[model samples]
Each structure stands twice: as structure tokens, then as C-alpha cells.
Target: MIPDVFAYERPETREGALALLAEHGDEAKVLAGGHSLLPLMKLRLARPSLVVDVARLYELSYVREEDGFVCVGATTRHHDLATSDVARASAPLLAHVAGQVGDPQVRHRGTLGGSLVHGDPASDLPAAVLALGGTLVVEGPSGRRTIDAREFFVSFFEVAIAPDEMLVEIRVPSNPGEQWAFEKLTKRAQDWAIVGAAVTRRASGVGVALINVAPVPLRAAAVEEALAAGAGADEAAQLAAEGTDPSSDFNASPEYRRHLARVLVRRALQKAGF
Candidate 1:
């Protein structure tokens, strides 16, 4: 499959890229690492008239400490995250998920912002972000706005980012001593998860996020609430599918997905020593 002909512009600055998006609006698409968008474009599922490439925006390609949180630029590649000592020490869950995203080639080219902004329900990073309670910084003509990861994803391949906005950075607080686990079930090592679970426990509370359980990456509210109420891991994990409306697809039946969700949630909880 070939993508429809489209104009491309490599923006050296973030504002330049934003300007392109501001002008083209719905007809434009942002190209970060291009791992996700290029595939959709190649299949003709997305045929934007213009591609605003931000890969060369050096300022948007870093992993740094901001205040007490780790601020990752939108163009920072997954391989960087997977290999960064700062990320591994403070946000081990993110580093672990990054390594699990795809094969080495995909990780070398896939960006955290691209994965989160692409908003695929089965993606690893989004679920990890949700579990880690991260925030997305989106820049637009009106300036910037921050959206919590839990509220960032709206539906399958859908996010809260406006058409004219571009994700600039992701911010996550350091969780050095937190217990975390990510469990994904897939037919092949590099394949997308059929169903996945990410669990994290801090001094405050436990967070449980599910992948491929609904229209969007979702935190298991029922399970979280049960944990908060002092329920055991097995008891809380049994409710992992509560309120989810998963669809039956070629890879799995709705019931099968629900079952996987429960199994993975329980395993994640156990690994987190819940």
C-alpha cells in the first residue's frame, strides 16, 4: 500500500511545527518518529495533505529532570527511554514498557509521544503512562495545556489533543521505591498485547491500568477501589473487567479478553507484591 501524495515540511523549531498544524488544521498530521502514523498513512487510513515533521526539532528530543518529575520531549525515541539510566532509576515502569513496545528497530524509531498521541488502546506506553499517573504537555496557538494521562485518552485511536495542538512533553513524578509490574499477553514477542495490565503501588495507593479492555486504555477503577478498601489481590483482580465494554475481534472474544484482563491483573498484582 502506498500513501497518497502529501507535502512534507521538517520544522527545526517547535513553533514552526505548531504553525504548520495551525494553518493546515484537519488536513495536517504531525510526524514524530513516524512509526505509528506512517503505517496508517501507508494503508490509506490516514491521508493528510501535509506532514509536519518534528523529528529534527532538537529541543523536542530530550529526557531531563524538571522540578521533581521527569520531562520527556515528544521526539525522544523509545530506545532512549529504554536505555536511559535516569528513566530506569526513577520511572522503571516506563523504561520496562519502552523495552516491550516492539522489536529493536521499532523501539529505535518509536517516540513516547507518538505512541501516546496515536492513542492505540493496545499500546504499551499509554497504559504505562496511565498507571504512572503522568501528564501530557500539548502546545497550540493558544499556548500550552497539560492533560493528565488518565484523562488524555478518550477512545480507540482517539485522544484529547485538539487538531491544532501537538504534544510537546510528558511529565511523570519520580517513583523510585514504588512497586510496579507490566504483564502483556501476546502471540508473538513483538506483537501488540491481546490483553495487558500495568500495576503500580506507592505509599499513597495502588494504580491498575488495563490495555485492550475497552474503547481506550483504561485504569481498572473497580480494582483500584477494591485495593483502596484493603481487598486482597485475588479479590480485587477478579473485578478487573468491571465497567469495561471490550469488543470481540479476530484475536480474541470479549469473554476471552476479559479473562485475560483478570489473569494479567492478578499476575501484575502478585508481581507488585500486592
Candidate 2:
């Protein structure tokens, strides 16, 4: 399972990378940490003509706070997020979830943007970001625009990002000292979740998001709504799988995933002080 031969370019600047994308369009693929894209390429599921590597773009590898949000560069690694004081203070749920991703090697090389853009329903970071109510910033030939995390995942393995656009930053509202928790059922320590739930309680309200319970990383809207209407965690969690369409796989059946969703969501909500 080798990838097809492809031209490679390490862009020195963000603009340089965008220029390459604009030139090659759908035939080009942007490479960040390579944890996500490289696997697809190696499997021959993705056969791009060109790879625009942005791994060396130092400017896009930072975690900082600005205007009441924690802003993370697209190239910021999961290990960085897990260890950053800024991330820990402003977005503890994200920091914790980042630490929970894969093993140490994957955390050190996987970028937050890469994970989010991969749009995997079972990925930990996307569900965490969704629960945190984060936003994604993308830059392309047209310039930069912001997209709500809720609207970013379009479908299974699809995101709102266009071929010519590259995600640049992730913004989550600063929630210093917030109550948050992430719970998941995994077969092994580093295995992907059979079902995962991330919950956060900010001044705004409670946010609940689930992984591997639908075609996309899903916000448990029924659970959130029930909570908003004065329901207890136990009652709200009953609706955790109400709107999901989880698939039956060797790891778990759809019914089993739905049951896990309810149980994990309750655990997360309770831990988050809901």
C-alpha cells in the first residue's frame, strides 16, 4: 500500500502554501503534521499530484490567548496543546482531550488542525472542539474566514474547507477554571473510542458532543436541550443517542454504541458538574 508518486513542496510561508494549493486545486493536498493525510495517501485512498508541506511554517505552531479566546495555530501539535499553560488555562477540555489522542508518538506529531480537518467521526479532538464551541479559521486565495465548529463537519470524512483553502487557526472561548470532562470507551489504551463524550460547562451553558455515534462528530443536541430545560444529568443523558445514526462495526454494534453514548455522556456531564 504505497502512495502514488507525487511532487512535494515545503512552503516557507502560509501564503506560499496557499499559492501552491490555488495552483494545483483538487490535485494538491496540504500536509501539516502528516499523521492524518499520510495514512490516507499510503492506503492509496488519496492520490494527489502535489503535496504542499506546511510542517515547517513556524508561525503556525503556537498557542496564545487573544480577545477572550485561546487561538491555536494550525500546525500546533497535540503534544503542544496537552502541555501548553495557555491551553490548559483557557481550554482545559481541549488540553485533556489532546493528551488522550492516540499514543505519545501520535500526540507529538498530530496537529489539531489536521485532526479536525480530517473530519473523522471517531477522532477525539473534533468532538472536544465541538463541545468547546470552537471556531476554525481558514485562509485561501480569497482571504480568511471563520467557520463555527458546529458547521465545519459536513459529513463522513468531509469538512467545510474547500480544496484551495487551508485551515490556519482554531479559536475557543477562554474558559479559565471551567468545569469540563471527557469520557470514552476504548478497547486498548491508545485505541480509537468505541464511543466518546466530551462535556463542558461554561458561563454560557453546558455543551455536549459525542464521537463515533453518527456520520460525523456530533453535538448531543438532545442531551444539551434536555439539560437546558432543567433536566438532571441522568435525565438528559437518556437522549444522548436520540438523533445519532451510529454504524455497526466489528468493534461495536449501533445499539451498543447508542448505549455507550448514554452511559458515557452521563459520566462526562456529571464530571463536568452538570
> What is the TM-score of each predicted model, taking all chains together?
0.98, 0.99
- Model 2 misplaced regions, further than 4 Å: none
RMSD of each: 0.8, 0.8
Q: Write the per-residue lDDT of candidate 1 for residues 139-217, one digit (tens) a residue.
A: 9999999999988998789999999999999998887887999999999999999999999898878889999889899
Instruction: Give the alpha carbon lDDT tens digit for every residue of 178-246 in model 2.
Output: 899999999999999999999999889988999999989999999999999999999999999999999
For candidate 2, give the lDDT of residue 154: 96
Top model number, lDDT: 2
- TM-score of candidate 2 on Cα atoms, chains taken together: 0.99
TM-score computed on alpha carbons, candidate 1: 0.98
**Span of 10 residues, lowest total lDDT, candidate 1:** 57-66
